[model samples]
Target: MSRPRPRARLTVLAAALLVGCTGSQPLPSTSTPAPVAADAVQDTNPQPRERLRDGGLLRFPLAALPTQWNPRHPDADADARRVLDPLTPEHLALDAAGRATPNPDFVTDVAVSHEGHTVVTLTLNPEAVWGDAAPLTAEDWVATWRASTGQVEGVAPVGPLGWDRVTDVRAGASAYEVVVTYAGVDPDWAQPLVPGPLRASTVASADAFAWASHRDAHYAAPFLVAHVDQAQGLVTLERNPLWWGDRPKLDTIMFRTVQAEAVAAAFQHNELDVWETGTSVDRLQQSRAAADTTLRTAPGTHGRSLHVSRAGLLADAALRRAVLMAIDRAEVGASDLADLHEPPRTWSSNLLLPTQPGYVDQARATGLANDPVRAAEALDAAGWVEGPGSRSKDGQRLLLTFRTPIGDDLAQGEFEVLAGQLAAVGVRLRAVTGEADLTPVSVPVDAFPLARLPEDVASVPAAAELVARVASEVDPVRRADQASQLARLAWQEVVEIPLYQEPQFVAVRNGLANLGAPGYATTDWEDVGWTS
Candidate 1:
């Protein structure tokens, strides 16, 4: 389950290769020339699609990739997993069938200390080289850790303070080692670290490991600062000829940005080889029927929920609860969208694995139910007098301003329906476009008692913690409890009403194999190949 990042505030600004195998069977190619008239064709045999050769080209669809390639920076995660590859990569990358495993492509082995700290040792293919032809080394790993941890200033923006817990990072003669010591017990310590390209010996000689921290000089990963090609609407990726693993199949991975609706059309017309966009159920069903493409469904890290501003009339807890009791969630879930959307039961729907440890069921009982009587009772208790058409409290009108992302048409439609539901209870709901700030007066993630909230509570635990720390009591236990309460309050108060879960749709050309959806926002692009 993934959560949507809050688009309201502008304050915080930011921000892969494969090998060969034994038996060494070549992948069948799918490349073909532009289709010609049936009578004008010379050869009847089907031409193979160009398989990933040492210098072939692959095209991928993108809404946007990161501008910065550095992984340690605060904005790095958005691009690190997709644009910049991870150095100390996770073992088990995706959990599809209850399987937690290591990523064999990048990580060789990992060891954990008694204190629950982890030291990940990485070994790249001997042939692997930096984009600059320098052999990747443990030194590069050390520099990446330093840059991300901000142990050495002048690197990319110092990542969030959470990175400070990394006690030590060292590169050995052979393998790179990263030791992460948590303030408390971190259940997931083996998460991958971003690997940086090796610095030139000349640069290294001048600054040693400190070279990576220098913002002025170009060390490695120059793609971070490179300009986007407006014509292509993409950031072109040239093959790293020095890369150790089997060179990428494509010479250049063309990443193009197109609207979600246009993806299926693009795939049908050969405008794209792969399509990645949040799709609606109707669109997904239509795409799945296309003869020329394959549809892959993966649970995305993006989650969808109704956001309520902490300011305005919604600040009242009683009014918020009244709003929560007015709408129907099941109806929203069933008719929300025609694509791959699911209804969210809690704020952690995107973060907590439903079957994983520490998951509590709080919203199971008070989900979206259409109960005008209960809604009226709650509003009455809050000093609201219900008139024929609307309700008023202390001469103040009961109203709310709802905000959501503009690109999400399905969400926009749901908001319209939700506004109508609230109107029955004498609540005036105004839907605002663009990002609106929802802070200070927000509800918990567990059960929203309020009808609307400002904060976006999704899968990112750190962000959730940040919200919890700021809005609730300050103790750790209390903070965690506050996080849970916020989640609950959102549902219970109907402050932050959940709309639906966004679905990630991947359109692949037929015959592609080993393609997996990104796990927890981390997509391993190296392992996928044309299987034929």
Candidate 2:
């Protein structure tokens, strides 16, 4: 099963082309050996390529083409953005744990002046320029800020971060220096600017945003679009001649749209250089079994939680609490694993992922784990009496309409197993297909500072108040304390039971380095090469 776009405190933050193949041929599938586990932590950091030669073709797969090449556009395609974001743009800094450091490739230095309104001065690399030879100067940054904020008519930002608090963005001492003056000291000011800048021309009007494409596009990164055969669902990128940085190792990189089910087969056949096997049990088996394939695993940064709708029978906190206690999150996660190498790890806190800092064991603190006796007590106290194969409160039957995305086999299995578990506890879980409620899932979070959190947790008022405290308080220890309090509040109310941080399994062919399971760190495109 493909992993859902993970819910991260920070937004989840992908290349190239050239002289490899003149024509595309349908890739033939081949078979290989049993998959096993890798020895190292799953990472996308540059690997040693000292024994490797330069210039080879790297092929991979994306699920689909992005509807729009402009990732900022409301209709931008997710798969396309996944590849385009890192390959064609420059950011002031790369996303990492703790404070994000300036990207020496794009930025020379960043300084802050707190004397008055929060003023930030960013110095751009003098040699950095767009593919079209236009200097990527402070003006481009200012244009991006203006276009993103909707200050430029017909343009709107991707989200409302701290940009509304901005007072001005002006050229500093030179064209390469951008001085931003905020209306207040906003801790999350760095959140919105990470996508780097839309070229000055692209941000000039609404029409220009739609002018970019996967086949022919302007780029500032180490790679540029070399070929795009949409009919064959293939995109190829080659080294960018205008790139000011070190030359990238591979001459070409290709992205072909491969269905989720077909990924394991494709990788086993040697059609792909790497596979991003996201929480798929079958894929895990296949990856482990593949001869010469190295498997990388890591603690996930995203949370897999049960999103309960307030309009359902679970509206009552007691009923929701009962359901949480009835289900064994460990079992549910293990079922998803189904004999995979790593055993499932139950999520303890809603606010922090297992790998992050400030994580507290709120699940234990709230005692929301599997306990049918406690579940029965909560149900009974809520006036739900046990009946034939189900429970009843007043005239209503304890039937909940559970939903998961269509075509998700793992979700289907999870729901089926959960239904049986709930049924054993006098509750009826009706597995139904419904549209995802994106409103509750898209809460913006900055990973490093933990500056902001979701406004509410459905009906939990205390959670909302606690999250507000987490957002405002400047002290890290105090923020962690407030976060723990809020997590405990959510758990007590059964706002959501985060099942497990889904493990990401990645398989890379031997000799390929600097590429694998991309985590928070931006891939250094130039460093991706092969070992001899």
Candidate 3:
């Protein structure tokens, strides 16, 4: 099961937070292009791969490089996923409608049997091979299965929920054919090779699987790792000669690690080719000011969220309820959404976004709303006497401290709004900024919030069980119903609190193709190039 990051500092009554954009063969256009359709799938000037320019350096910036190239490694993050996408073999490909299909480049065909237990048969593409010309076979799947399941000594994967339940991995009729069997019905049977399986040699040793990993994410995709400059925080990928799929459009894709504050300057100075404008009006304005640039906007489920400490000062449910009620979700959303030109959208369920079907907005539900009057009354009933400026209970002032990063002007600004909202309800909110032990987290790519619970916990909320039930249910209608049930339970119990849905705002140089705020659509790296 996935769990929240340990170190914590920081969201809302409902709880929410941040995510976001691009650039550079400058087009002949003299003005910043108008915003594309305000919908889920944002624009990247979508064009055919044959039409895009074949050779150009695509430079971008990364906050940091993945500690390990292995996607299964605990240290690997979304950065690692992005860096490896252009090079790694994908067994499963997601379509425009978010449907998972067997990738013809790796697995040409797939068959799943739900007889007694779940068994998935994958026919590997005969042309698929490793950088060494070694045909990808069942051995790779076996290695992946072993490494992913923490049962193997000295091997630990980040999120191995579905993989851990896999019982066996063996060859089918031929080495190119593989069969995977699970202990029971495997809900995510297609995930055995979702991000692509690892080579047996690369993962045979625990050392290479973890800390000893290099930045070279060598795989048989469209590109290969060219060089890694650790001190300079730069990783470059070049066209892979051994790749059997469509040739990557760019000759080289370079990613340099730069701090958040320096990204705008880097992009403006032409040191960087693309940058995600995020919620920063300054960055958006700068991108709009640049010639031949287009701002792509899309409704996204991803955003920032603050994890409340259940064991801390506000351990009691009453205190937590009061805090939630005291928060003005609209004000918080407005603060985050101001420059993006999006209206404040509030949510109480963690898993269900307003755009999705079966969604129920419980932000204004009875007893759980942004009502300062009700909040003060709840606090008063909880034995916290309201003083002139603050509330005190048992000689202790009712003060809650919120910490944010020193340089994070966005967080600091949001904190001020949140502080003002709470003060009206007589709750003292202390501000702490600097190396906070808080995690400002982003939402999952699939839009489904994973159930974050202790592995050995004796009990779990009904909502968590519903999440599992929904995952296990095979029927579409039944699964949808269970999902609705899960969403209701999640909000009713605050299992995974959600504040607002973040809209994707990407700044791309005009003529760039097949890369933008592609909500739910997998990145087509081979088609990403300049159309000019």
| C-alpha lDDT score of every prediction, in listed order | 0.45, 0.65, 0.64
Per-residue CA lDDT of model 1 for 1-532, tens digit only, reads 1122222221111000111001112122232111111111111112222343234345666666554444434454443345444222332343331212333333433443323333333444343344455555566556555555545544543322234545666654555443444443332233324322334332233234332222223323212223357666775655443334433444455667776667777777777766553455656676676776777654444445555554567766667667766866555655554444444322333223232222334456345345778887888888888776577767776766666456766656677777788887787766666544221112222111111124444332344654534332212234334445555544554445544433346766775544534323333333334644
Which ten contiguous residues of candidate 1 have the minimum total lDDT? 13-22
lDDT (Cα, tens digit) per residue for candidate 3, span 106-137: 76655666666677777777887877778888
Worst 10 residues of 3 by lDDT: 13-22
Measured against the true structure, the TM-scores of the candidates, in listed sequence, are: 0.61, 0.80, 0.76
TM-score of 1: 0.61
Task: Report the C-alpha displacement of residue 145, candidate 3, in angstroms.
Answer: 0.8
Runs in model 1 with CA error above 4 Å?
1-58, 62-101, 114-135, 151-153, 157-162, 171-176, 182-185, 191-266, 280-290, 333-335, 339-358, 365-373, 404-412, 432-495, 519-526
Indicate which candidate wins on TM-score: 2
- Ordered from best to worst TM-score, the candidate numbers read 2, 3, 1
Q: Quote model 2's TM-score.
A: 0.80
Give the per-residue lDDT of model 2 (tens digit) for 1-532: 1112112311211000000001122111231111111121445535654544779988888999666776667776677777785565536343323234456677655555444445667777788777777788887878877887777778774642556667788898999988887675544455555556767777788777664565333467888878788799998889888777767788898899999878888989888988877766667778888887788766544656677665557667778788888988788878877766666567766566654556677767877778988988989899999999789877888877666566777777788888888888898877667743111121222444354454345236746676556544433456567767887887787656677766656788887887776534456677788874
Selected candidate, larger lDDT, 1 vs 2: 2
Cα lDDT over the full model 2: 0.65
Report the lDDT of model 1 for residue 370: 56
